[model samples]
Target: MKKYVEIAIVLIAWFALILQLIILKDSLANYFSYFTILSNLLVAISLTPKLLASATSFGKRFSLPKTKSAIALYIFIVGLVYNLVLRGIWEPKGWQLVADNLLHVVVPLAYFSYWVVFVNKISLVWKDMISWTYFPLVYLAYSLIRGYFVNWYPYPFLDVNKFGYQQVLINTFFVVLAFISIGLAMIYYNKLMTRNR
Candidate 1:
């Protein structure tokens, strides 16, 4: 059942992403544009550990377990922020609406559910929480650099041209803080679970 659900999420994400690009039409012209959006990057990020867990033992290697939980928490943040802060901006219709929800809502829930239902409770530590922050920071650095060159921001809060670097940096700082909070909470939860056992 877990494996099947993982497969479903991967399929659904790809299906929605392709359909969304098709619907956008104009955005399709810029190839690099596709990877810039956080939603696309997140679904792909969320997919990695799921795929790793089921098909191979790679997820347990190269600090992949740390990365997995971190990405899961990040995607959770993505969905939460979208639903709470950003949902009103897009007036998607029909299939676009479906795809929008799938990407923004469904995938995030599925990934979280996968973590709760499928992931073994590892005894987590402070190092795990610290390790979780690396990828997001790199992503932030990359996004800022690219935004400077291309004037294309994936999220409005991160748009330096419009919001300016100060505002965007502030937003990014909060996001990083939130990531740390979530990572700590995840570790705490795992620790509690281990204690119970």
Candidate 2:
């Protein structure tokens, strides 16, 4: 049953992503620049092995509790930040609406549900929250550098041209802080679940 749900999530994520890519076919680089796309891609890629239950080294590594938890954290952030900051900025229509909701809403909720129910929580630790910071920080650096050359940003919070560097830095700081805070909360929830179990 868990495998089935994981497979469903992987399919939904890919479908949404493909739909998005087709919509943005002319500006593929801009399409990939969004953290939402990258995070959903990670969810689809990381969980894909669950369908096969493979014994390969890559499968085993991705199957680890840490890897699962990190992907969950990222996808959760995608949903969180999107709903809170970007949801109302523009209205999507037609196939774009389907792609938007699936990528931003369905995939995040489904993946997080899978994590809470199936991923092992006993092995998670407080320091894992700190380790989770690496991906977002690296992504932030990448976005800023890429935005420098491309003259566009995926989200307004990270848009230096609009907000200027200082404001963008402050925004980045808060965004990273949100990521860490949510990570700590996830660790707490994991420990709490473990204790109650």
Candidate 3:
């Protein structure tokens, strides 16, 4: 049952990404700029190995509890930020709409569920929570740098051209704060669950 659920998640996530890739093929660079796409890509990549019932190194590595937890944190933020901050900023239509919801809503929830139910939480620690921030920090830096060169920001709050440096930095600080807050909560949950078990 877990394998089937994971397979479904992998298929759905990849389907949404591929649909968006097909629709936005002309501006492939811009399409991949969004954190939504990248985070969903991570989820799909991390979860894909579950479908392969072989004892491969890639599968074992990604199957690590910390790896799934980190990816879960990323996709969770993608859903929260999109719905809370980015939703209604622009309306997507047709297949793009389907892709939008899948990336921002369905995939996040599904992957988090998979992590909560299937991932081993006994090894999670405060350090793991801190380490999880690396991906988002790197992504933020890459987005800001690329946007400076390309004059295109994936999300409005991070748009330095419009919000300027000070505001963007503040916004980024809050986003990181939110990430930390959730990471702490996740770590706490891990401890609690493991203790009970």
Candidate 4:
């Protein structure tokens, strides 16, 4: 049941993302403009192995790094932050509205559920949480560099051009704090879950 649910969510995420691409057309020339897409795509694709594991021996062997769990947590944060901070700004309509909710709301819930209910337990540590920062750090550098070149920023908080480096950096600091907090919770939650089991 969980496997089927994951497969369905992954399909919905990908299909909606593709539809968004068609709708936005030229606007998404730089696909990385939205972290929602990057995180959702990564988490959805990463989940394919687990979703397929019930059927294929190859999927069974598709062992992934435990650190991928951090990506799952991060993607959940993406959805959380978007709905909390950015959703009202978009005011989407029709299919845009549908796609927005699926990508930024439904997909995250689905992936997090898969993680909690289906994924095998892996030992987690503070070091694993530290490793999670690397991806977000690299993404920040990439977004800043790309923004400098293209004069576009993905999120208002990170728009160095408008907010300038200092303000953007401050915003980034808070975001990093949020990431670390959630990462710690994830590590501890995994430990507790294992203990209870």
- Minimum summed lDDT over a 10-residue window in model 4 is located at 58-67
For candidate 2, write residues 1-197 as lDDT tens digits.
98789889989998999988888744877887788999999998887775665587777888989889999999999999999999999999999899999999999999999999989878988988877899899999999999899898889899998999999999999999899888889999988987887
| Candidate 1, 1-197: lDDT as tens digits | 86687678778777767777777745543433432245445556456565666455544452255655766787787787788878987798898788778877887898777777776658457787777777678878877887788778777788888888889889999989988888788888888887898
Candidate that beats the other on TM-score, 1 or 4, i.e. the better one: 4
lDDT of each: 0.71, 0.89, 0.89, 0.77
Candidate 4: residue 22 lDDT (0-100): 73
Q: Please provide, for model 3 over 1-197, each residue's C-alpha lDDT reduced to its tens digit, 9 standing for 90 to 100.
A: 88889889999999999988988844788887788898999988887875774378888888889988999999999999999988989998898889889999999999999889988778888998778999899989999999999888888999898889999999999999999999889989989888887
**100: Cα error in model 1, Å:** 1.0
Model 1 is weakest, by summed lDDT over 10 consecutive residues, at: 28-37
* Candidate 3 Cα lDDT to native: 0.89
RMSD of 4: 2.6
Residue 43's lDDT within candidate 2 is 92
Deviation of model 3 at 95, angstroms? 1.1
Q: Arrange candidates, best TM-score first.
A: 2, 3, 4, 1
Pairs with backbone N, CA or C atoms under 3 Å apart (clashes), candidate 3: none
Error of 4 at 145 (Å): 1.0
| Ranking 1 against 2 by TM-score, winner | 2
- Local distance difference test, candidate 4: 0.77
